[model samples]
Target: MPIRSEWKLAREGWTLDTTTRLLKATAFNPLITLPLILAAKYTARGAQVASQNETLFRTLKSLVALGVLGSISGFLDDKVVNNWKGDEWDWKKEVVVVTGGSDGIGKSIVLLLAEKGIKVAVLDVQPLTYEAPPSVQFFQCDLGSKEAIEATAASVRSSLGDPTVLINNAGVARGKSILDSTEKDIRLTFNVNALSHYFLAHQFLPSMIQRNHGMVVTVASLAAYLSAPNMVDYASSKAAALTFHEGLAAELATQYKADKVRTIIMCQGYTRTALFEGFAGKSLYPETVAEEIVKAVLKGRSAHLVVPESSWGIVPRVRSWPLWMQYGFRKGLKNLMKSWKGRQVVQPSETQVEKEKKGVEESAVLVEEH
Candidate 1:
């Protein structure tokens, strides 16, 4: 599907970054350049043209050289530079735990892993809205509470064994400025979005180190790098989450000598989810982010994955630029949230509540029959 116009405009406004991405997708694309070179050479030969052929030869040479350089660079990045040697993960033996797996990107990840026959334990405050396959088990737990997380972790270990992959995906956003945010709102945001990661890692990392095998996936936001109005708390928590992941990864390698235990940090853009309902911006689909998460796990690599890959270059360099340039960049991004109407809180209908009650009764009867 085509991206919304508003999102396109926001990205286009980041002139240098957008232009670089365009060149990479076109001029540096081997498939397009290789075909063009072949066509040019063929035309030169068929026309019996000598003078015009000079341009064709030069173009062909440049394309070939670019292709070779690109290939070499990719080889070095994949084989030599990256220290993550891929490991074979047997799905049957692995237990996957995803926080906030009842909805949005977390839900997508839960469904995907469950469908692959991997045992998945979902820890969330809400019950699963959809019927999950047998392989997926739902554990009701409020992530913001450290005590709840610890108790739930014990339950998970008793039922499904220690989790091999831990995905800290739960998050909350108040979408209020620092002054407007109440104390509870700020605490909830930080506890759920940032502190939960530390709690879960402390609970689970020891076992992973004992086995010297595991993967930790942290789902942060692009807000970590760039902030705008009414997102102060949300962005700050995400930044903390990013830092937590970095410290955990380093500690695993240096303190514990468990370098094989992989860590992946995903900084995703605004996604099409209920959590960000009224926020107007270019948003990626939940499934797309889920797919990237799965791919990273399968590769068993420690790397940062940014959605809209264009931000890969821009985000890291933003803080190092001149103060005026940094302020300008942030000012452009603030426009994205100007049309934002925050998500409305909806209470469940009476009919829906009755249906849930009936479902619980039916389950009770089935257990009695068994």
Candidate 2:
């Protein structure tokens, strides 16, 4: 049998961040330097020693210095630069609302939070793939519909109290070029991926402002920075989402005077999920991405997280390059997606059938009232 793409990448250490971490641990570790220093000292005392002893001693000293410098730099980067700290709000009091929690990275996040004993409410059109504990509640919601989101928010508030954390994770990607995309496809993509964030924030942010404590997490993609051929709608929506996150964060600090209300925007690379099944190139595991988001939230800081960390500088500075260079870069990216075979349609589970039935009944009642 052929090896799976995710497994093959993991085994070969294709992820740049993972490879860099391993190299640091083995090659730049101070523990490794200590042994080398001792070996050099012992070898120098032998009769066979020549200029090799001097060279070894100098190399060991340089390695030790590098190791110590790296340690200090890491400490300062985490503490002084990032300013990461423990959670400020009580975990018991935190009620989390995660949109699109039925599958993919959203599902991973919901599970992780539930495992930590936090109250989690999932707002998704689909049903849960796995059984969840009492801490997790599912609210069937079509995020593309503003009316559906408003109704779902009321139900969530009634059931779980005011949500202290809002994760706008719902998104749709129609793998179609501008000319190939239908009007409905474009609208649905934008509504679900971008406009839903606006609606959700409007519903939940005022309460967070009043309390002066909350966390809003936006899960975007690297496509926000680089557009490809078949992902025009997807990339545009992500760019909108990224901009919305930045604007919201700025408003929280400057206008609302609520800096404690943390905002996190995650621009992740392609993730290993059913959504991107036949997409080529290196991709991150959903679990790894979820864990990073959870860690950032718990640390109580506002940040823009870029997966691989290597893209942190490059993605933001692409526009600064010459127009020809920019064109070349985008062309290269477009060529990569020429072979994409993303999951065209997803089958709804039995739980989804039940949820759809319930949603129809509730929607009828809501429609009657209007």
Candidate 3:
């Protein structure tokens, strides 16, 4: 489905997110900030030497100082997050695997990669909303079923070669209170949003470790840190996904000694998608989210990105705030999703459960033998 023009205008114009664009270019783009820093330095010096207005000169000096500090801080942060290593990603040789790529942000990612002439394998239960390009292949798989993921992984390898990048982006949300959520609802949320990361990594990470050249992008949400009512299961699953990304990054660097095998996790705010159809409050465009993920992959670096960039300072720190303050923040979001009419409830069928149990039993045997 095409994005409406009014939504595009709203996103681009002076709406709630107007500042995000400025922040992206200035605070986020060091390339842009570096030039500004130099210009500010020269201007400040000229004003000081020419005996111009003291207040103006002081303000310019302060701006230059702040710019220099921001640039240095960002550079150091990038080095730490990316392990002080560099990688040259050859898009021509990269095989990208994106789960739930039939629509929404996943689909946008697939298309963006395909546009760059990268081979893409999309795993989803539904078919693509549009025609698949020559560079794109679609695989139908139910992410909630472990067996299906395994079978799909094999097919992806055979069809597109070993995946150089694995995006664990498939997710489901059942908007129900904890007491109202059934066993199936809770299990399905965890299976797709959390455990599938484990299963997919099991299938794909070994090759990355051996080659020391790959990326794993986990698409989580801000809810991972700030849990609200009516979506407790979704928040819990995302939190688990957060830990999975952290643990995977550690194991790659420490256990496997694969520092070049990059891992990125995005804990973004609400995005405009079918999954969040009637969502209220400020939201991000699907393309905006996809563009950031794709740029990180092409750069071949690990990062922990919080979308809108403006929320980075606050969203992650909510957990560390005072108890009453945290409670108040969550309480204010009580009605944020009150009008949500997004994706319908997800059901983990009896057949899917039996298949998952079988997969678990087989995995146990393999582990014991190994």
Q: What lDDT does each candidate get?
A: 0.76, 0.76, 0.79
What are the per-residue Cα lDDT tens digits for candidate 3 across 1-370?
A: 3223323444534743556655555655646545544554578764355365666545545655666677788799888877889888888999999998988899888888888788999988777887998999998887888998899999999888899999988887766779987686688889989999999999999998899999999999988888888888999999999999999888888899999999999888899877776666688888878877888887888988888666777988998999999999998888877887666222233335545755322221111111
Q: Write the per-residue lDDT of candidate 2 for residues 1-370, one digit (tens) a residue.
A: 1213332345325567666667577667888876766665577553244244677567667878898798988677545322343337788889999998878889889988888788999998777878977899999887878888899999999998999999998777757679977666678788888999999998999999888889899999988988878888899999999999988877886799776688889999888876676676678888777877887777767767888676776876888899999989888876556656554222122224435655422221112111
User: For each candidate, what TM-score against the reference?
Assistant: 0.78, 0.76, 0.84
Top TM-score hit: 3
Task: Please give the RMSD to the true structure for each candidate, in Å.
Answer: 8.8, 7.7, 7.2
Better of 1 and 3 by lDDT: 3
Residues 94-184 of candidate 1: C-alpha lDDT, one tens digit per residue: 8889998988999888888877788999998777868988899999887868888899999999999889899999887767668977666
Candidate 3 lowest-lDDT run of ten:
361-370
What's the lDDT of the predicted structure labeled candidate 1? 0.76
Global lDDT of model 3 = 0.79
- State, as a TM-score between 0 and 1, how close model 2 is to the true structure: 0.76
Candidate of highest lDDT: 3
lDDT of 1 at 324: 100
